[model samples]
Target chain A: MLTFVVFSVRRAWQGFWRNSLMSLAATATMILMLLLLAGFWIIQTGLNAGLQFIEQKVEVVADLNDNAPADQLLQVETTLRGMPQVASVTFVSKDQALQDFRARLKARGQEDLTGYLDTNPLPNTLEIKLKNPQDYGNVVDYLDGQPTVVSQVTPIQNLVNQVVTVTNFLRTVGVVVLILVGLTVLFIIVNTIRLAVFARAEEIEIMRLVGASDAFIRWPFIFEGAMVGLFGALITLVVLAVVATPLQEFMYGFFRVLPLQFGTLVVRDLTLLVVGAGVGLGVLGSYVSVRSYLIR
Target chain B: MAPGSSTGLLRHPTLAGDRPPETTSERLVLALRDVAKTYPNGRAALRDVNLTVPEGDFVFLVGPSGAGKTTLIKLLIRDELATAGQVLLDGQDLGRLPRRQVPRVRRKVGIVFQDYKLLPRKSVWENVAFALEVTGTPGRRIGPAVDRVLRLVGLAAQARQLPTQLSGGEQQRTAIARALVHDPRLIIADEPTGNLDPLISWEIIQLLLRINEMGTTVLMATHNAEVVTALRKRVVGLEDGRVVRDEVGGAYHRED
Candidate 1:
């Protein structure tokens, strides 16, 4: 068994360099396909991050009555914070709301109509953030039940529903596109490796005639396929690194307002994804291609 | 030159003097009983073909092209299944051998092709050793086995040359060396001298005769009437997929 493995590895190394043209062609195709897959995967990751940011923006604002007691408001805020669906609940006093209104008016160059009023009629509120956007309705209903402390819950249910619908559609489309691209890469890579195997049909035939076990003939090609995959992945990573350096500023500028996660986390996932797919597909492709020759 | 004058051909270390090679006197090297083969396209390649080659016998298979010569060889190598009967190699039924056991059984029979199926990229030594290498023979064992066979076939000096660098006879000799590396009980030569000049063809025929004299059974399929007639060996003639004649000390054609 040890001899077999050593022989297979040595043969694989020789076979790869012996047919350098075909091997190089296979590696080039593998690199191109991996790059395309990695590009799509990075885009998909960014899409997910942006959608998560959008979902977190779905908050429930509950306005308290002007005459409500401070203790009742505090109790309501504590209860909202304790709910499993609520990520956090912050108390906003009437003074802060009025101040925010004045700031927005000043920024927009509108007249300070709010300051002209003799008394501040703005209501104090509790802004509730949910762990998941889909739990918006449950939190709104819970806040509405607190009629004594909560005067009226802002009916942003329609806005939340619209946002959820758009975000869900985009997420589904993103996943579907990723799957389609994955299948395309699989077919193209497998076929390209098949062509490489086909070029050596005579060698395989001679091996078979010489009473070579299927494993003896098969494992060498599998190792060769793996070599192609390894080389392709390394080349892809180098190209991605070179390109990422120049594209960093452009990507940061475009995603500044979107709050997408783009750092070491994304880079790590992309590396694993590209390398894993490159090697896995290479082995699978060779296995499938060489199967027909060995069956008889 | 007459094959008998080939002085050193049969005198090598791995040749005639080497313990009279392990042939079981009572056992048959190959046995076919009522074997019939019809391809998927409904062409009947062989019908009611029954042949038995006992230990240490040399047989000649002669026929026109498409007379089931190739199909017969294919069945012997287990490359194709007999659509009807059994092909027994060394008392084991080929039809019933498990898929994984096919290679083991193939190693018992060494085969040579007319085209000399040598890898162009590999040297003569590598080509011969390839048979043993792919069979998972130990590296230490492969080197001597290959060396012995190359010396037996008189190609040891050209062992480093590639197939393209050698003549047709030299390439065929390399192939025969590869076939012999496994020390197979049966050596099947399928028109092995088809591409050679008559003089070179005689050289290959003499080499096969020498191997046969050393206790290996040889089944040669050929269209060479002159060599076949001159040898007067056991002849099995196939016509329209049927064995029309089987005779010992027979000429290539009927005496009439």
Candidate 2:
């Protein structure tokens, strides 16, 4: 059995190397397919990360009445804590709010917020963080349902809605592109291996006549395809690590002015791609082509 | 039992007519009964052809182009099924055998073709060993088996040479050697000497003869009349997909 395996592998290697052009073409297709798949995966991962960051910061603000009693404010905090959707609620007093404003102003070298308002009139605020970004509306509804707090304003509501809509849209686009890229990769490798098989149809026929079992004949070509795919995936990973992340980060910085690391994202994604879809797809493509020929 | 074993030989003289047949009993090695075929394009490739080949018999089936010689050979090997009638080997119909069992049938009947389809990339020794290796021959057994067959075909010296590097005659002999590696009971050669010179053809025919003498049944389909007449073996002639003549110890057909 060991000898048979050795012979089977040796024959496949001999056939692959004997026709260098076909072998090279198969390798090239596998690499191209893997690169595209990994690139798509990396883009999807980075976009998902950015969207998750936005989702994490999405929350509701509660505006307290100017003359509301301190004990009543404590009642509202307790009310928020009882709701399942409300994860936590923090009270920001009027004085504390003013202090926060002054700290922001100090960063701009203009820490003089007390001189503008004669009565020191910033409202007491309630900052409500929810268990889910999508449940922000539920928190707003629960708080707004109260008779006394009906007039309270949430300035972050519009921004939250816009972020949710845009993230959902971008996710849909990402899924569509992922599917398209996957199909394109599959087509490229399948046709490439099929062409390789066609070129060696006579060899296949001779092998069939010689009583080489279907598996014995098939495994080597499949192995070759896997090798080609592995090589292609490696090339794509290198290119992704060196190119896509930096480009994505540059684009993100242009859009949001946030500090983004293109290199780190690419490195992380490339590792996943080279190991997962790279090896998987290489074997898959070869198996499909080799089985098709074996039937004939 | 071994040929003429003590179990049979001891009791045979007393039994007389009731004794079992000899080791050389004339059992049918291959039988094609009323086998006919028509291509999808409506061309009748073979029609109502009947042939019976006995064990240890070297029978040549001769015909001109389009006379269905190759088609008949294909039917025996189960490469092509007949459109009408049936083919049998040892009373087992070729049509009834599933493809999985076809390899076993092929193992019993070896074929050597005219074009010499040895793998160009493989060495001559690997080419012959390819047959035994497919039949699940162990690694140690393959080397000796391949060497023995290569010696029989006079190719032991060039065993390490690639088919592309060898002469046409040598390549054909390597193919023959590969065919014979498994010691099949029936050897079918379809125009085995078609591409060779007279001297080379004579050498191959002599090898075939020697193998036949060693008790293998040989069915050679050929176009060479001179070789056929010289051999003076049993001949079955085909004309337009039908059998025209069957002669024992016969020569080739003549215009006169």
Candidate 3:
């Protein structure tokens, strides 16, 4: 068993270098296809993250009557916190609301005309965040039911429905596009490796004639294919590493308002995907190509 | 049993009724009985072909192109199964052999092509060693086996040269050495001398005769009628996918 593996690996190494041009061509194709797959994967991940960020922004805010008792405000806060659908609830006093209004106006370069008012007209507000944007309907209904404590709840149900519809469509489209790209990468990489194997048909014929077993004839080519894949994957990872910082900067700049970050988990997953696909497709392609010669 | 053992001998006193019986030491290396091969495209490449070769015999397969010579060779190596009957190599029915057992059977029969298929990048020594290497011979055994075959084919001095550096005769000898490396019971040479000059052709024929004398059977497919007629050995002639003639001390053509 050890002899077989050593022989196969040695032959595979020799085969790769002996046909350097064909081997390099196969590796080049693998790199390009893997890069395409990784690009689509990154885009898909970013789209998902951006969509969740948008969904998290779907919160229901209710304006409280100035005459509502302090105890009633506390009760509303406790009730919102106890609800399973609500993620969190925060209470803003009228003074704090006025201060926020003034700060926004000043930051927008508009004059602080609120300072000229005789009294603070802003109302205390209860801000409620939901676990899911789709669950906003239940929270809005509950807030609207508090007639004595609440002056008015923001009419955001239509806006939330629209956002959900658009996000779902985009998510579906992103997934479909990623799948199509993944399949394309598979075929292109497999075909490239097939071409490399086809170039060595004479070697396979000689091996078969010399009474080499099916494993003997097959494993060398498989090892060669794997070498191509490993080389291609390593090169691709280097290219990714070189461009990673720039790529992340470009993504952040492009989607300035979207919360997109390439966390360590994403990096690890991407590395695994590239390496796994490269090696898997390489083995699969060689197996399929060599099969035609062996079966005869 | 050892490959050349007399225990494996198949007495054909009844099988070949007209022919006189040979010494009891001779064993059958190859046999075909009513073997017919029809390819997928409805081409009948061979039909009703019956031939038998005993151990250590040198036979010439002579025929015109497209006369089932190639198909006959293909059948011996189990490259294609006979459609109608059996092809037995060394008393083993090739058609009944399992897929995994095919390689084991092939090692018993060494094959040589007209083109001398040697890997261009490898040296002559590596070319001969390749046969044993791919067959999983032990590393230490490979060197001596390869050296012995190279010495047998008289190419031991040119062991380090590539195929391109060798002459046509040398390349053919290299192929023969590779075929001999396995110490096969039978060696099938398909037009091995087709590419060489007349003098070099005789040299190859002499080498084959020497190998046959050393207790290895040789079956050569050839178009060289001059050598075929002069050798006066057993000749099996094929015409339009059927064996037209099979005779001992036969010439290239029918004497009567």
Candidate 4:
């Protein structure tokens, strides 16, 4: 068995270099397909992360009456924090709200006219972050039920519903597009390897006539296909590595608000996807291509 | 049992008539009984053919073009199945052998084509070693076996040369060396001398005859009438998908 394996590997190596054009062509196709898959995969990852950042923005805000007592405010804060669905609760004072409004206006290049007001018109509010954005029902109702201390709670159910629907639809579409691209890559790579195998039909016929067992004839081609995959994957990783810094800079520039942590995750996922798909597809293409000639 | 063993030699002569009839399988190297082959398109390539070549026999298959010679070779190699009847090699039926066992059966019979089928990129040494290499022969055994066969075919000096560098006869000898490396019981030559001159053809025929003398059965399909008539060996003739004649010590054509 060891001898067989050694023979197969040696022959596979020889076959690869002897038919350099065909082997190179197969490797080229493999690299192209992997890049296409990785491209879509990167886009899908970005889309998902962007949608998550949007969903995280959903929260319920309860406006406190200006003259509400300190003890009542402490009780409300404690109650909101104790709730299972609420991730956190932040109290924004009237002064802080006014300050935030001015900062936004200045950031947008509009003049802050807040100095004309006799007093701060913004309300002190408790911002409630839910563990799940979809689970805002209980928290919103509880805040709305606090009539004495709370003037009004934002009715954000309609807004949350609309955002969720659109984001979910977009995610589904992105996944469908990725899957379609993946299938196209499979067909192209498999066909390319098939052409390589077809070019050596005479060699296979000679092997068969000489009483070479199926394993003997088959394993060498399989190993050669794997070599193509390995070479393609190595080259693709090199290219990806070279372009990575620039690509990251571009991503940050476009999606500037997205966290750097999400970018790292995308990089990790892309690496795995490219390597896995490249090697897996190469082996599969050769198996399918060589099978037609093996069947008696 | 060693290949080409004659079980007939063990028979007791005193009670031969009463010992019951001998079945054909025990003595035959290859047997085809009532065999017929028809393609999917309904073209009949062979019809009601019956042939038996016993152990250590040398037979020539002769006929004009499209006389089912190629199809018959295909059937023997299990490249095509006979639509009816059996093709038995060494007592095992070729058609009934499972797909996985086909290669094992093929190793028992060495085949040579008219074109030589040499890999242009491989050296003559590599060409002959390729057969053993692909068959998973052990590393230690391949070198000696290949060298031995190369010597037998008188191409040991040209072993490292590529096929393009060799003469037509030298290339054919390389193919024959490849065929013999397996030490097969039967050698099937499909017009092996079709591309050679008379002198070179005689050289190949002499090599085959030498191999046959060493107890390997030879079934040569050829169009060389002079060699066939001069040799006066077993000849089986086919015409229009049927066996027109079968005779031992026969000429290429029938005697008056």
Interface RMSD over true interface Cα atoms for each candidate: 0.8, 2.2, 0.7, 0.9
Pick by lDDT: 1 or 2, better one: 1
Candidate 2's residue-wise lDDT over A1-296, tens digit each?
A: 77667766675566567666766766666566566556555555655565566556537887777766667667777888998888888877789988888886676465585876777677777888777755676678767876464248573646656755766786677668666765666666666667667767776666666555666667767766666667667776677657765777566655452334556556775676676776677678778877876774
Model 4 chain A weakest lDDT span, ten residues long = A255-264
Residue pairs clashing in model 3 are none
Off by over 4 Å in 3: A1-29, A43-59, A63-133, A142-171, A179-187, A246-264, A292-294, B1-26
Q: What DockQ values do the models have?
A: 0.62, 0.29, 0.64, 0.66
In the range A120-164, model 1's lDDT, one tens digit per residue, is: 898888777778755677778887888888988864555656656
What is the per-residue lDDT of model 4 for residues A58-147, given as tens digits with 9 covering 90 to 100? Answer: 478889999889898899899989999989899999999999889867875778899999999899988888887768888878878888
In the range B52-154, model 1's lDDT, one tens digit per residue, is: 8888888999999999999999999999999998899988899999989999999999999999999998999999988888889998998988989999999
For model 3, residues A87-179, the per-residue Cα lDDT tens digits are 888888889989988886776567988878998998888877777755777788888888889989974545556656766786677668655
Best by TM-score: 4
**What is the lDDT, from 0 to 100, of the residue A167 in candidate 2?**
60
Model 3 TM-score relative to the real fold: 0.79
Better of 2 and 3 by TM-score: 3
- The digit string of per-residue lDDT tens for model 4 on B1-256 reads 2322342112111121122223555588888877899999999999888787888889999999999999999999999999998899988999899988988889999999899999999999999998988888888999999999999999999999999999999999999999999999899999999999999999999999999999999999999999999998878888878887766666787663
Candidate scoring better on DockQ of 2 and 4: 4
Kept native contacts, as fractions per model, are 0.71, 0.18, 0.65, 0.84
What TM-score would every model get versus the actual structure? 0.77, 0.77, 0.79, 0.80
lDDT of 2 at A28: 67
TM-score of chain A of each: 0.63, 0.65, 0.67, 0.67
The candidate scoring highest on lDDT is 3
> Which residue pairs collide in model 2, if any?
A31-A232
